[model samples]
Each structure stands twice: as structure tokens, then as C-alpha cells.
Target chain A: MIEEITSTQNAKVKKWQHLTTKKGHQKFHQYLVEGWHIVSDALAAEQPVVQIIATGEQLDAHQRELPENIETFEITPEIAKKLSDTVTPQGIFAVMDILASETIDPETATGAWLLLDRIQDPGNIGTMVRTADAAGFRGVVFGNGTSSRYTPKVVRAMQGSQFHIDLTHGNLEDWVKALEARQIPVYGSALNDQAEDYSTVTPQADFGLILGNEGQGMSERLMTQTTTNLYIPIKGQAESLNVAVAAGILMFKLNQKLA
Target chain B: MIEEITSTQNAKVKKWQHLTTKKGHQKFHQYLVEGWHIVSDALAAEQPVVQIIATGEQLDAHQRELPENIETFEITPEIAKKLSDTVTPQGIFAVMDILASETIDPETATGAWLLLDRIQDPGNIGTMVRTADAAGFRGVVFGNGTSSRYTPKVVRAMQGSQFHIDLTHGNLEDWVKALEARQIPVYGSALNDQAEDYSTVTPQADFGLILGNEGQGMSERLMTQTTTNLYIPIKGQAESLNVAVAAGILMFKLNQKLA
Candidate 1:
């Protein structure tokens, strides 16, 4: 269906604006992805992109390539600005359906995966997702207390890496138990005597690596459940690494591809 | 000397506000560090913290430990808000002098160092500095076009890692040439057929690693100048890793402590 949305106060526009917020995303079970790159990625990946809204100029430019069935709206530049998070709106946006939570069967789950334990920064969360994809991880789980993957800032940060990997939210403790039941060693990140230097560990084909909150680290309960926690030895005066940077290092270290 | 300045319009308060800008820091060669932790870190490092400013409440809380020789001022909470970059002002701030740039004599230089080529984000620059410190790098050279280390946002992101190691601004072309003159292998990050996997390169105590602008990667000229550009082989679909995260992986790869 094709329609024009000229008023910023239109009911549909108001609903779309709500998708920009966490509460709105949760309530509507939908989120917005702005810019041509993200919208194109969603379409190319065959994700559930339910709608595409763009300024008339943008629609004219991309109209030929857009899929036929998705709902399309022509919006005024003013309406575009109302829905924008960035200072300059790219004028193209998509409404993506949030994936429903599904159970991961211990019997069938394989390949490396990343788990977040209360990792709250959207930028950090997004970077970790991209890094996990780059490291060839099969998926990432947003554990309890972790920000929703559907948060606009996070979806923006993931740079369309979301389409390349599975992202879901679940209790990390349950994730640990599942991976363990499958006989895959799950690694938690921390610094202590029991935490082995990350480089010393042999890279594995199938494993789980859990990164924790920006401030407090992995919960003690989850730390004990992992096969072993690993630490990237800090050789200089820096007390710790940025959570995203730390996640990148550990993911790359534990999941290098076999030649 | 200690004095009370109750108004945000006071000359000192006005000047302190100016210090938050790039032009102001350049003109006066001074930048402000807010919050007690950063302020205290500056004092402990003894990094030419010339003036201390705080509200009466905060001053009373910390006055006993402040150095006797440094000039101190008491200001109203209104002035505190004026100087604060954060929403909730910590009520303590310090003025720090920018270090004078000195020639890096290639003959005397040793140990791993990071080079930034046109990298502009303060947060990325600061995170890279902290990662450099964590990886035990000797220093970082902010090449031409990179954001100033003295930028308030950069300093805040660095979390005082600036004091733990050397930070200087210079032309990266000269830096690469200088390191090469001393028989030090300088590596630029990029992925091409000619580039070697970062992991294949033996870790070195004396080396230089160059990271480039987030979007463009290293300039083609500098890419050719380095001993050999390094590539962290991405096994999956991410277009690229976050610049800071890439730096963390490379720095840790090239500068691991010898057993």
C-alpha cells in the first residue's frame, strides 16, 4: 500500500515516532531503522521490514528497487525531521519487526556465540554485535539487565550486522547451562588468579564468551557457572579496558578460524 | 590564594567556560577537567594542575588533601553548572596546561607506540589511548587531523590514561619515517593482498602501529610507508571493526609481554 503522510501529528506518524523509544519498541514490538543503508540491508537480508517511509525525493530515487508488498509512505521533510535521532536525517526509514524470543535447544546449538551480562551501553552493545559477526559467531544473547537489542541506538550501531547474525534476549544463567549441557565450554571475562590469560587458551570451533556490564563485571553466580573465566592481561597502568574493546579482543582471541 | 566567586559572570568563571572549546584551549593552552576523580588523578600525576575550582560543599569534602601551593577557588553551584559538561555537575574542576610538543628523536625511541592518522572522534581517541596504556605501549602520537588530546570530551573519555604515558601531536608521515630510520618496524592497519595477518607477525617490544580515520582507513601514502600494513582477518560479514576495538586487538597482538 502507498500513502502520503504530510502531517507530523498523523496517527501513524505518532505511532512510528514512538518506535524510537524503548518503551515504545516494547509496547509496539517494532523498531525504526533510518537511512538507505540500513533499510536496504533489512530488505536484502529478507528481514521482516514491514514498512518504508521516506521523503518524496528519496522515494523517487529508490522506488524501482523497493519490494512490492511492503507498506510504503511518502513523508514530508518536516515529518522526517520529527522522527530523526541524528541532526541530519537521511530521509529514508524502515519499521522492522522485533524477532520473537525462541528457545535454543542444547542438542542443536553449535558454533561460537557471544552473551552479554548487563552490558548496557548501546554503542558498546552494537559494536559487540558487529564484532561477534566479524569473529564468525553464530549469535549473541542480550542477557537480563542488558539493554534491548531493539533500542534504536543499538540497531543503528550494529550497522546492519544484525542481519548477519542471530540476536535474542534471554537469561544468561540459562544460556550458560544450555551451552554446558551441549558440552561447549562457556568463557566468562574477568581478572583474577583463576582467570587464565586469554591468549593462553586454545581457540575453539564451538564455545560461548560472555562479556559483562561497563562498570560491574559478570555476576558471581554466572562467573562460577562458566567452564572458566578469562582475562586479557593488562601490562600498563590502565585499570581496565572499554567493555566493547575487551569484548572484541576476547572474541577474536577465542574464535579465530581454522586454516 | 582562595577566593569566593558567587556569580557565573565572574571573569574567572567566564574564562573557565571558554576552556571547554578547542579554540580556547589552543589560545590559552589550558583545558578543564571536571569531577573529583579526574581532578584528583591530575593532581596525583602532578601534571601541571595550576588551579582548582570547586563549590563550597565539595571543597569542604576534599580540602584537606589539596596541595597547599596550588591556587584554589570556591564557587557557587551555579558556576559549577556553567563549567560542567555532565548533567549532574560533580562541583569540582581543575585547569591543566597543555604539554609543549617536543621532538621525538628516533635514536632514543623504543617500545611499542600507536599512531593516529586523521582519527577524529574524541571517544575513539581516548579509548585507543587507554588501550595503548593497557597494552603497555610507550606512547601515542596524534597525527595531523586527529582530534586534540586536550579536548574536554577526549580527556573525559581517556579517564586519566593521558598522564600514564606520552601523548603528542605530529605529522604521521614523519613519525613513520623516523621509526623506520631507527630500524623499528612500523605497521599500518589495512586489509589488502600485500598485508599480513596481524597474528602472523611476531610480537615486538619496539614497534609502531598506525590506525587511521574511522571511515577511510589509512591514507594510501602512509599505508605504503609502513614496514608492512597489518590485517586482522575478519572471518565473517562485518564491513569493519570499530576503530578503537581494532586498535585494542592489534596492540594486544603486537605488544604482548614476553614470558
Candidate 2:
């Protein structure tokens, strides 16, 4: 039903807010997506979207192209402003069920996979996913303490790469062991002197490159479990590269072998 | 001289606000750098600081660590807050002189360089500088109406890499011609079908990798001047990668051959 929304206290508005927040995302097992670009992407991917809410002006703007099967609601700019997290709301938002991503059988994969450890910033996590997708990575696994994969900032930063690849969250040790069992080599990044230049590591038939957090590099416990610790040589005066940039560099280099 | 900063109308506080506006940055040639980590990074880089101002309490907390050569001043917390750009300023702020970047005799350097075209985000520019530093790029040249290299967000995002590298802003044509004269191949990125995969272009003795804006790719004028127009292979669904990430990948791959 395309109902008109007048009040900010409407149940639908509260639901949208919840979908945007952590508790709501966890309780409902769904997250909010903003902008017509993201909503259009979700529809194009045939992903399950619970609801679509847009302003009268926006709906008119998108009416010719919006799919008929999806449920939609109309709200005023005031209602939309209140519902949006952005200062300049894109006049559209959607609630979609979180996709269930399982560990890939590395034995069958042809490209590299990404392992993110305690990568705190949502923007970094999102951008890394986008980079990984562009570099032809098979999937991305979030180890213990990484940002929520479904956070709005990350999803936006990823620019819909989330829909294109497998994204999983689980224990670090088990994931490493799983890759090993499949004969896939896993490399951890470390700041130590013994670490080989990242380019030196030949990306295996199916390999995983782990990137750590912003403040700290890879955790000592996680580092010890990996096959090798790799380092990107820093030629300039900066202390270290941002984790996402480092991951992008590694992923790109690994893909070069296949190219 | 330690001054009492009671009102937001104080000359220094006004300058901080001015840094936010384009005319202000143009007129003053100064920008704000917020947060403790960034300020500490600037100090560590030994960037010339014209004024180092902090609250009396903050001075008490970090007085000994302040550089002996730099001038220091203490203001009230209220005054410090007025001069700050962030919601929660770390109680330290400084006015640093912008470094004058020298032109590279593109003929002499047989290394990788980055040319940014109309990429507006300051954070992206800063992150790209950090990535360029990590990948051992010779320097960065900005053209095509991009944000100033010295913007506050770029400064904070750069994490002090700006101090360690050469960054210039000006015409794109001359730089390309200079590099070509030196026999250095320039690879410009675009989405055209005639463009080869980025993997196909071997990094010559010296090379220029051009990254375009987020919305617009490379301009036709600049593309025509490039030795080769190339595209990064997007194996999956992503239309493109972040410019910074794309640059990082290209630089890493090119530099690996040299390393």
C-alpha cells in the first residue's frame, strides 16, 4: 500500500529510524539504505527490500523507472528530513533484510579474498569492500572487532559493492583455519622488520590477505596464526598507510598475478 | 604573546572560521587542522608553525612536549573552543605556513607520479597523498579544478605525508608535455572500449598515472595528450573504484616492478 505519511510519529518513521540504528538492525535483521541510487541498485540486484519510502517529489521523479513489485510509501520533505541521517536527505530510503554470507570454499575460487581485523571506521570498511570488489576479490571476511558490515556509512562508501560480493563476520582463528584446511594461504600484515615486502608474496591459487585496524596493526594473536607477515615498504616520511589503502594495494598486486 | 580569548570575534578565531570558506582560505592562505593526533603529526613532521595556541589546562598537560623553537600561547578553554573547527577540539591548534612545492624536471625523475583531475573531496586528496607516499611516488600534480592540497580535511587525512612529498597545483598540459619529453609514458584512465586493461601498460622508467574526479572521469583534452588511455578491470559489479584506491593499486603495481 502506498500510504501517505503525515506525522513524524508514524509507526513507519520509527521503523525506518530503528532500521538505521544498531539495535534495530540487530532486532529486525535488516538495515536502512538511502538515496535513489542505492534503492535502484537493490532492486536491480533482486535483493529483498521490506519497504521503500520517498517524498512526493522524489516519487514523481522516479515513478517512470521504479519497479512495480516493490512496496512503496510517500512522505513529506519534513518527514523525510526527520527520517534521514544526512543533512541533505536524498528524498528516498529503503529497509532491506541483511544478506546471509557464508564462508566461501576457497578451493573453488580463482581470485583473492580480503580479511579485515578490527578495522574500526565504517568508512574504511566500506571503501575496502568497494576496492576489493573492483580488484575482483571473491569475498571479504570481517574478523573480531571490525565495524558492522551493514552500517549506513559503509554501505554508502562501498557504493553498492555489498550487493556484488560475499561479506561474512565471524571468529578470526576459525576463519584462518578454514582457509588453511582448503589449502589456501593466508597472509597477515605486520609492522615488524622480518616481514617480507608485500609484493614478494605470490598470491596463491586462492589466497586471503588480512588488513588490520586504524590505530593498531594486526593483533599479535592473529599475526601468529597466519602463514606469513607481510609489509608494504614506506619510502616517504609518513608513519604508515591507512588500512584500506594498504589493503587495496595488496589486493591489486595479488590480482596482477592472475592478469 | 599569551592572549586572553574571551569572544569568538577574536582575530585568530575569525581566521579559523575563515579557513572553512574558499575566499577565506584564498585570502589567508591558511587552513585549520583539528584533533590531537593530527596536531601531533604536524609537530613530529617539524612543519613551520606560526602560532601554537592551547588552553591553559592543555598547556599544563603537554607543555614539556611542545617544540622549543615554536611559539606557544595559552588561552581559556572557551577561547580555544572558539578557534576550533571540530565539535570536540583536542585543545591544541596551530597556524602552519603552507610549503612551497618546487616543480619537478619531469625529465630527470624516472619514477611514478600522480595527476589528480577535479577530485573535490579533501579527505580523498589527503588519503591519496598518503597512498602515493607509501607506494614511493615521486610527487603529485593537481589540475582540473580540484580542492586545494592544503585544505584542513586533506591535511588531517594526509597524516603528515604532505610534509614528506612534493605537491603542486597548475596546468595539466605542460606537466604531460614535460614528462613526454623525458620519455616517460603517461597512462590516463577512462571507460572507453579502446582503452587497454591497466595490467597491459608496463611501468616505464618514469610514468604518470592520471586519476579523475568522482563524478567525471578524465577530460577529453587531457586524455588526448596521454600516451595510453587505460581502464582498471572491474571483474565484478562495481562500475568503478575510488580514485584514491585506483591510484594506490596502480602505484603499488608499477613501483613493485621498480622495487
Per-residue CA lDDT of candidate 1, range A59-154, in tens? 989989998899999999999999988888989999988866544554567898899999988989999999998888998988989987877788
Looking at model 1, the pairs that clash are none
lDDT (10s digit) by residue, model 2, range B121-182:
78789999988877778788888598877666787788777767777775778778888887
**Model 2 / residue A195 / CA error / Å:** 1.1
Report the error of model 1 at residue B239, Å: 0.9
Give iRMSD, candidate 1: 2.1
For candidate 2, list the clashing residue pairs, or say none.
Answer: none
Clash counts per candidate, in order, are 0, 0
Candidate 1 chain B worst ten-residue window by lDDT: B99-108
Which of the numbered candidates is closest to the native, going by highest TM-score?
A: 1
Tell me the tens digit of each residue's lDDT in model 2 across A1-259: 6889989999878888888778888898899998888888888888888788999989999988787777889999998898776889989988898756545544454457788999998888989999888778878988879988777788789888887888877677777787777777889898655798886766654788889988988888889888888998876666788887888777877776543
TM-score of 2: 0.91
